[model samples]
Target: MAIMDLSSLNNLNLDAGSIFLLAITICAFLIPVVVILPPVGLQKGDALLQTHTKAGVEGARSNLKNQFSAEEHAPADGKPPRVHSLVVYPVKSCRGIELARSRVLPSGLQFDRLFMFAQLKSPFPVAVDSTDAEKSQHKWEFVTQRQFSRLANVTVDLWLPDEMKLRKQSMRSDEAFLILRFPWKEDGWRGLFATIAAKLGRGRAAEPEIEVLLPVDFPSAAEIKEKGYTFENVKIWKETINALNMENELPDELRRYLGVSNKLALFRVDPEQLREVYRCAPSEEEAGYQPVTGFQDAYPLHLMNLSSVQKFSSEVPKDDDLKELDVLRFRPNIILSGAPAYDEETWKQIRLKPGSSSLYNDVSFHVSCRTVRCKMPNVDQESGLRHPREPDKSLRAQRAVDEGAPLMGCLGMQLTPLFDPSLGEDRAAWIAVGMTIDVEERGNHVYIKQ
Candidate 1:
């Protein structure tokens, strides 16, 4: 029995050794393939895709403090008023309207960027085949900068089908078309119209052109009444102000008016301060932080001031012909009128009442990050026009791109609560005022007094 057991053990050992050798040989052959092959065909992460950090926020604030201390202390005599303007972009790249009252929501302003036009086909460089048809077929997806930059130019007029009859006009063919104009360059018009035509097919040619319309009719009281429209048109009226005219560009009165642009709806925060409280940069974390609650984008919030717009206008090329300083280029929810130039860097907190609510329910929002300007800022919001030439002739004008440190506007404050009951229960949550702000600047890391 002992000898039989030993023989079985030897046979088992031989079999185990052969199996182990085979496994090693297979692994040796497969290891190099695993190392060389890309994972799921994804490219290497981009270096430009940086992770914003508290350290970066501290550096930004330090530079801002040193450069603008005097301007910050300069008497408030000529400073803009403390009014606020609350603007909402119902459709993503189309025009946004100033709200008399709005609700605060977690994602952003209620009904903000809720509707968008998806191109059924590429509006540019027409595609030759339907093999990649998915690229061209656009659904009415949510609005974002990714779809259109001049989305603020696309205005809409809501109607009950019957009211729309008046604006509908018949052209050459028995077919009537909607007379729609975008505020930005008409570059995409041909493509957009063609796409629309294709979508309608030959069957609807006799019918009036049904364009995607925003609820806003016109900006002026007279225009709104004359048009017999029911949607908000405050932005249209404000743009008609002489201050926004092409020649005058930025107006002095607008500086004063900026404060009341949306006093109850907007807030500004110091990014460094925000990082200290969350223990992480804004984009790196989820949306529970005060800043994320108000400003839905990756950055803290959208910010713009009359002073900064004016500053950009002053640097327009001397030899070039430029249009008015279009504020709509930067789609900011809250437009600040009174803050000092570049003062957003140091701002800590702001207080505002929610729209449609009694004054008793006023809310507070905290400032989180500094808004960085982009090339889109150069587009003319009124005409839907863009610079015709190259980098030298572009609308960026004199704006300089600062890598580590950039100038920003204290547009408005972000809040903790995502929704405000005043706007509506179904509306998205909003960031409000009265929230505390944490600053993370180099030596002065601390919370700002509300």
Candidate 2:
């Protein structure tokens, strides 16, 4: 294939290096490298530099169709999305911990909810762990799932003391200690010999399983709250907030299996004390930072939309005391995937990106509202039992259309963690579980979540 002899190409001296090598071999195989610039009055040693290279490829394709038509009038399809799952809860409407990766704190995950259940303050029988030093002047009222739906089968598991020499250690939840394991059922014959020795797997203790360890307190001195804490303000809804009780020691068989009387009292949320999401931002020192929380009733990350929770599991009401319904009854602490169910209410802010703990990449979060739907998703975190009227009666017949949030049923949102590097913040951005989201959308509206 070596010809080059068109009559000696007119004695071949077409200089300017053979017309810029024949205009880059006929426009570098045709266009698109920002149309090889050099237009608006062409210059590269012009001899009509190949006739202004088609006016620099139609001005780089009309400036790439006006910047993708301004990203099709932006609001994010900037494309990213994926983090499928990673729950936390660690006590406060209990039973949570599902992680293939986690530690994105600020307030969510990383020992979320911190530890709750207060109410033992007024009148009612109160006497299970009654250390009668005049019952430390009784007064502790938080208790949740609206009002104890067995507080969702309470379960918490955290370990620290040198396993793998502190695998990626992160501290300050008062330095580790939360074991708690419970569940007991007995009626007769010591629950019938602990249910016939459980088919011989050695099931004793009248078959209810126990395990406790507790001790993780740190509200920090001032005499431990001027003398062994009992502070407690706790309301969480109209946000009374501020808690401390829990001098650590709860076990009279977990106050008769959480019926709560024997001096249970464990509330905790006071370190660095900020709690002001001021109802969707603009308070924690005017949003410069600080949305602190512990017994999370409101904000510190939630985000759920596994296809709008499998389409709200066929919109509830499916017979036999309502079963098939667990996206952990809307508890969510990050669980997105692809999009469109309720299309994550239309995002507002998301970033994430980093799946295997290099400490986590990007990591953002702003979505501050729409979690509304209370009645604590009708309880049932594995039979803590509550389902009286499902999904708030099918979310008041099709998501109550938000009249500024009446009879709520919103489906996941609420996040705050703006920065973290272990809170001193210089951006560590951590977040796990498949991680990779981007989203933004500021207009498809969604706010109301008092």
Candidate 3:
């Protein structure tokens, strides 16, 4: 029987070497597919799942979660909470207006930060005589800290028409105000602060007058007020102007804006205090883990609790003359009103507009992470405006504890909107927060199923 079986095997013409070669060939193709394909599918699946999960979670968390267990479902203070205050900056970096209602686009707020000034130097005779050249040069010049710290103090009224006009307030002489034609003829058009100085032969001069730019066709506040484009408050303008002024002293490579973001779009409010929970481990130490390269920039949304602001205000000294809490220092995108004490950090999700209307036509924003506070908040927004002897200790104390540290009380959310390139400068963006996601906290840096 054994001899017969051996004879049958030999007749089949299959050897151990042949079998092994076939197995190796099969693995070469299949192993890579097995290793690489699932991850791609997992990433796509995770993103989609996260978006839906966040949306559902936002509604539930806000309604169910509260700092005081007894107040979970009850409305705090008998008033509905405000989820976000949309702000738009018409110029790139100047200032912003808090809008009760705003038009949204894929980039962010519509008609926000669309125009910018480019600086150029020229001396053609015809160029010098043309009105266009004069207007172009005026658009380019800006004031910086290097020339005068008070350059930020200067404010201008921007009037848009066939010709743009910049009316500057008098600095040395209160009654002697100056009006300069933006885009001065001698200097090239498109440049912001630089063009203004170059045209007036004050390119080398320290502390030249500040200039403003307006769209040639857009109506003024009076004309647009009836059309629902009325001008509201503009207190945050100085903060951005100060940031730009400080950047001028730094190198060009370090400069984020070359007076381009004159129309400031957003301002935030960050928690003054935070506690560190844990530091992330290296990627190689864990199985199936990849380190996040931009971990430093991890925050997805910034949330400000209205109650927390009130709590801080209660601690102010009786002798101190503190005004409203300045929102510009923190630079948050969304400001939440009527939240329970320290409840923002516990929020897993936040919906911008619930059932009434979509955040932007057919889009919505999801809250994802906790916004961490930075050292920039320490700078007093009203330092130059207030008296020198005034005790500005609250901001200083807040900064001492918050510099380069994470704040625990605030929450952030990741906004996932369908990409639409035609939406122009209305791209949806995220804000900073300090907390780590559970998936990120565990060995799996890659997003995983909750």
In terms of lDDT, the best-performing candidate is 2
Candidate 1 local lDDT, 397-424, one digit each (tens): 3333323323322222332332343554
Tens-place lDDT digits, model 3, residues 265-317: 21111111111112322222321222221101232223455465555545544
* Separate clash counts for every candidate: 64, 4, 57
Per-residue lDDT for 329 in model 2? Answer: 73
Ranking by TM-score: 1, 3, 2
Q: What's the TM-score of every candidate structure?
A: 0.41, 0.28, 0.35
For model 3, the superposed segments whose C-alpha errors exceed 4 Å read 1-80, 90-93, 111-210, 214-303, 316-323, 354-363, 378-450
What overall lDDT, based on C-alpha atoms, would model 1 receive against the true structure? 0.37
lDDT of 2 by residue, 313-341 (tens): 67776877675666767778777665666
Per-prediction CA RMSD (Å): 28.7, 29.6, 30.1
Worst 10 residues of 2 by lDDT: 48-57
Better of 1 and 2 by TM-score: 1
Off by over 4 Å in 2: 1-91, 94-112, 118-148, 152-220, 230-258, 269-304, 311-317, 323-330, 335-361, 364-384, 387-450
